[model samples]
Target: MDTGASEVAHDFRPFFRVYKDGRVEKYKLIDHVRPVPAGLDPATGIETKDVVVSPETGVSARIFARTAGGGGGGPDRKLPLLVHYHGGGFCAGSPFDSTSNGFLSAMVTQANVVAISIDYRLAPENPLPIAYEDSFAALKWIAGHSDGSGPEPWLNQYADLGRVFIVGESAGANIGQYVAVRAGVAGIRVKGMLVVHPFFGGKETDEMYKFMCPTSSGLDDDPKLNPAVDPDLPKMACEKVLVCVAEKDWLRNRGVKYYEALCGSGWEGKAELVEAKEEAHCFHLFTKSERAEQLIKKMVDFITMD
Candidate 1:
């Protein structure tokens, strides 16, 4: 990910620039930032607000929930909490845009759950474990509100900390799994995990991951990237897990393999695998079709189910 070269050098432009002396320049998310709809969607009764997750690192998140007295958040006073992670290939992507905001808003109206879309630090500039660390820090910050005495009145008023779901898409899926694994060691309570097209590396080292995390020990050995080799996979602490993979996605095999490994690892939990026929990676986030609806509906049923 740096430029103090000794062997192979990486320069994945349009995403990042690696200069001499190990300085890396990253491109901003301008395209995704634009065309965003302003403020809450009153029609859906969904309201979103941004909060500082870690002020020191500029890490923040967009919190989504149905406003009080709104008809969208279901009949329950306290709803299941969904701590979500957006996918951007670990370099760029966010929950602040129109697409992500709209999606979260829809989830709010449909599933009636309070969602926290984390905006963790990206890589090349910050690197792999840094993103992971910052994500876990956000989770810890959220955990502090479990007592209902912590900051954030919305969480205190709406979120059911006992029934929490860690959900992610693509790279965010990878991060979600990491958080779930670390939560087990940290003793944090997480009900389940829903990962969509998880961004896991293959047998051959992934160039993207290598460029983002130059120090990583390839895909095969890094438990952070390869959960198949992660010993803690069986001790994930969560009660259940749902892994969704698209048939046409190159990572589909890996996601399927993960489900197989999880089931055979004696994880002692319910594991669900979903495949979107003839679909490509992260298609549900784009094409607003019946297939996408079905996928999101599956996710909603999983989150709202007992």
Candidate 2:
């Protein structure tokens, strides 16, 4: 006789697990000591609200904006609307989590733009392209507010439709890039793309792309996972792009390579690269180091620059 314990097929602890029976269980990296509610963040004045993005798919997102209102009321002066996606390897992570809350609060306060942090469907249960689809759907919902008759009040009241930006970190960056590339077809015009410590370049064994999307041929060829290789790289529908990388992170080179590829692709958009010395992936969220503050400063400048 055999024990009832299910054998593990792929063990990616602190993130997820795949059992021989095809079951996937994800583990949170850290337990919430005290749950953060949706409202004003004390340190930063950014207010957040959870809203239903899609009724049919049960897709929701956390909206970040200043209660006092931000730029866009005139033709010459308009605040950029930022659509952010969080980094979690496409398996786990949340926009409302404490870490995410802290970072986004600071970001919103500094940049003074209405932000929508997407909480897309996770993988193993939802699988690859689901997160991508959910994100695009969120963008479409944001676009719905362009005519000032959308469902959400905050977006209709404050968000500037003419100025839109896409921001993502790590795996979320991959998702953001995927959406930005496809936004043109959907008639979604974006002003800029901010990709921070993006996820690209992985090996065959326990590969991230293969695990998330079994249909992928490999990490190198998949356009969704590696935007650097996508033939549509030149067609990215954005006026500007900011690619951030940490010198110490393993994926730093990939970010650099992406910037080079974008510049070489004849995309006709101004692309800038910033590498934080001695920093790790998504370090701006975890530490108060000088480098972290500098990164935030750079990000603010990028968003607010005319």
Candidate 3:
């Protein structure tokens, strides 16, 4: 009897399925950094200028303003803004790290708008809510007026509140989605959201057992690293979501679930699930990957598309 089940297991890269003692075991690898090329520097490639968004929180961030083709725009020309958050499993990385499309620099150039990359407080030392609170505050600050403590030159020159976008990666994407959900509650309607490999939901399900094999689950086994949160957020609140998922990445399922949840929740937001056919999470960090270029181009098209 086939029983709608397969006796043959699938093994790709570090992922493998082992059936023994009337039980099936699944193995997945995490904690290893994907190899990105050396020449591509998403972090230091863009010309970064400093700015401050809040004095109360003492938050400092960089404002990357994309130069309109031919470098001719003065401060008066208003442009859309993408508030970017970098990936590091919520513990490592920065906005300057993935400077291409999802990062501040990339969003600036790709979206052809101002990119405000928020440097929120990290976890363990800061822990839950701190990162979330800081990110939300930054968005609010941008929508509102700037305080005196922030960088005057950058704020005065770049940044326009009318056209605002929110973007993030890994744990940062976690924060981005949370912000979008709350933004709706607070009457803050952002132009769009770019979520790359975001981690969502905290409760463990029966299927997770297979994915979390004793020795192969890796960092995902650690709650702090892949922490779970309240799952009651209203989906589709974000104006538009550019959901980028990697085929070989362990986080692929979670990203897909989040995307489906958004649509299921009845959000009018537009969505495009871009599968990096041969890539994995944070593959964009590797500049030389052919797939990386495809990912960046797609992201730019998503954000800038009229």
**All candidates: CA RMSD (Å):** 3.6, 2.4, 10.6
- Per-candidate TM-scores read 0.90, 0.92, 0.70
**The 10-residue segment with the lowest total lDDT in model 1:** 2-11
lDDT, candidate 2, equals 0.82
Clashing pairs in 1: none
Residue 243 in model 2: lDDT: 96
Superposition error at 101 for model 2 (Å) = 1.1
Per-residue lDDT of 184 in model 3: 75
Q: Against the true structure, whose TM-score is highest?
A: 2
TM-score order of candidates, top first: 2, 1, 3
Residues 34-95, model 1: lDDT tens digits? 44543577577677888888879999988888775743244356788899988877888888
Question: What are the Cα lDDT values of the candidates?
Answer: 0.82, 0.82, 0.61
lDDT, model 1, position 75: 34
Which ten contiguous residues of candidate 2 have the minimum total lDDT? 69-78
For model 3, residues 1-306, the per-residue Cα lDDT tens digits are: 553255534332233443332244334334443433223334435455556667777776766654434231335665677787766544455543434333445556666776777878754344455777888888777666333233355444565555677878777787887777777778876877888977654345323222432322334443323322224344434667788898988889888877776666556667778788877777786556678778878877876775
Q: Relative to the unseen true structure, what is the C-alpha lDDT of residue 251 in candidate 2, on a scale of 0 to 100?
A: 89
